[model samples]
Target: MATKSNSTKTSSSKKGKMNLKDIPFSKERLIELFRQMLLGRRFEEKCGQQYQMKKFSGFCHLYIGQEAVAVGSIAALEIGKDYVFTTYRDHVHALILGISAKEVMAELFMKRTGSSHGKGGSMHFYNGKTRFMGGNGIVGGHTPLATGAAFASKYRGDGAVALCYMGDAAVNQGTFHESLNMAGLWGLPIVYIVENNIYGMGTSTERSCAQPELWKRTGDAYNIPGRQVNGMDMLEVYEATRQAVEDARNGQPVFLEMLCYRYRGHSMSDPATTYRTKDEVGQWRMKDPIERLKEQFPTVFTESMVKDMEEEIKQEVADSIKFAEDSELPELSDIWTDVCVDYPGYPGREASDNKYEFPYEQLENAKK
Candidate 1:
């Protein structure tokens, strides 16, 4: 068993004690992390604008304030060799995994060029080749799926780890417990990340959970190593995830609770201000992940460079929108095409003529 690491906090609050030189990442890597976080924020901002303009038909969840949690955590993974999963707020995860902004935008616009061929909307963006398992709609539903992936990796000795991202509220679901039990028992290489943004759709964690410190609660339950990091601080998130990933790859299950916040509402439909105060939101804005990173390395990210990066990101976002708009929608007949296949002597549903009724309905005395 891997020795459990102590709960850690490496946020900006310790700025006086820790300087930029104290951090381990290289200048280039730090810049890349900032770019990734900025890109996710920009992409989601575009998504929110499109949702308001009715360019997309389904639900949209913006990962505005939680960029660090996705970018920092994913940076630790060996892409293509490892796997990733998340809930509906998954645009950031997909973008971080090397999926083009155009592919995700096209998916939102229901264009045939989308990752899911425009079939799976915002919530169901998938790319099996990239190993990003995509998002799920149900609360805590994907937990088991991630655990199963870890099981397969261990069985095949693939040396792969599964990174599962879930919200704070999802920890209460039964699948969370069941999956953790199985992972702990089998020593599967999986890490359960709870993006604890405090509010589970307007209700604060204190009101909903008995123990608000989720890192401790879930960790103690399954005896899996866990850590709580300031999600708003990208460096802290990166460091914590690096350790967790190391433990997981060595056949030890891990849990992580990212103490973060979301600037927007649960979904595009919600206003997000009725339950929380504007002052509270303002406080978090002061700790914006992008700004915090820039502050830590002022020399690396000068004002002029920051401005240039902003302009570059804006142009990239514009191009993605244009690409999605120019793309065509899926043909009506294509609807069930990618779903499955039919074979000789084992025809698919449409190819079969047999009809059947329920066993209870087949009884002569049963009511229609």
Candidate 2:
């Protein structure tokens, strides 16, 4: 499979902006990027379909238009060596980070086969084995966690870097400032990326932010270098993030603001049209990132090749859905498992001698 990301390899940048001819990557590599991006798009489209069918309950956020930012930026970091943290909008991030579509779909279906054993649901996705630290539901809740992950790396004398992803709305939270201040003061290896998708839920960036240029203002406050890039352009996002990851590896923290937009509402519930206009949405659709990349490889990505890739993505999604459906639901007794609680003198004779055993049938009524 073309799952290996080109961003894993290092590439030196030239003085000016990059074009298709000057992207410093091979045709196969570019096509792979396109393929992964299409996979993410199709995965989210399936999510939307399942949500409408009520396959699962609870809030669902789709990363429909922001595929370039997630795929391109993630491609720059080392898979296991580097860590990624994000907010509630994390399905695409999980997919790009090598989490199988089957596992992610299982999570959406709340099956026992999910990454978090079907417990975390759509918002709280945890896969510590891959160092993807899971997604936090609260705004700016995971910034300090990202900072701590970076601190642990530096403390252990490892060269790992933490990539903290947040939406534009989270920049205003107190943890954002506190985490950045510590990261800058301690020189932690972390890259803070703001996915500035123009809207914070229903409000526009212009209306919600006192300083609209998040990369500049936020970075300047912490004495960190920052850059704003065209998030819609996958190549631009890749290059910018690659450099930022390099800087972090060299013991420097950096910030980035990606100017992108979401095609769907903030969540499944929000219609997304009440605050924004249809004309504005159509204008952004015109700049569809996948179509733009396809234009760059008209000869290489012939009609047949593009069709094959699309069909492959469709089948991949279908397989994932079947996997989720086939998976069994968690047993009732599962509630008592995987829960970490501290008991006084645990693992000692004092605790063991004090333990009481109750019959499974009477357990519920024996609470008193």
Local error of candidate 1 at residue 140 (angstroms): 0.2
Residue 208, model 1, lDDT: 92
What is the lDDT for 326 in model 1?
99
Give me the displacement of residue 301 in model 1, in angstroms: 1.0
User: What C-alpha lDDT does candidate 1 achieve relative to the native structure?
Assistant: 0.85
Question: What TM-score does structure 2 among the candidates reach?
Answer: 0.87
Cα lDDT for residue 366, model 1?
Answer: 62
For residues 5-118, what per-residue lDDT tens digits would candidate 1 score against the true structure? 344333444432235577777778888889999889988898899888989877888899999899889988988989998999999898888779999899999999998888
Name the regions of candidate 1 deviating beyond 4 angstroms.
1-21, 343-368
lDDT of each: 0.85, 0.84
Q: How close is every model to the real structure, measured as TM-score? A: 0.90, 0.87
lDDT of 2 by residue, 1-368 (tens): 01211112122322233356877578788888898889989999999999999999899999998989988898898888899999999998988777899999999999999987888889988777678987789989999999999999999979999999999999889999999999988888999989999888998878988878776664446767767878887887898889889888878888888888999999999998789999999999987878767775577677999999999999999999999999999876565456666433333433435444446678767865
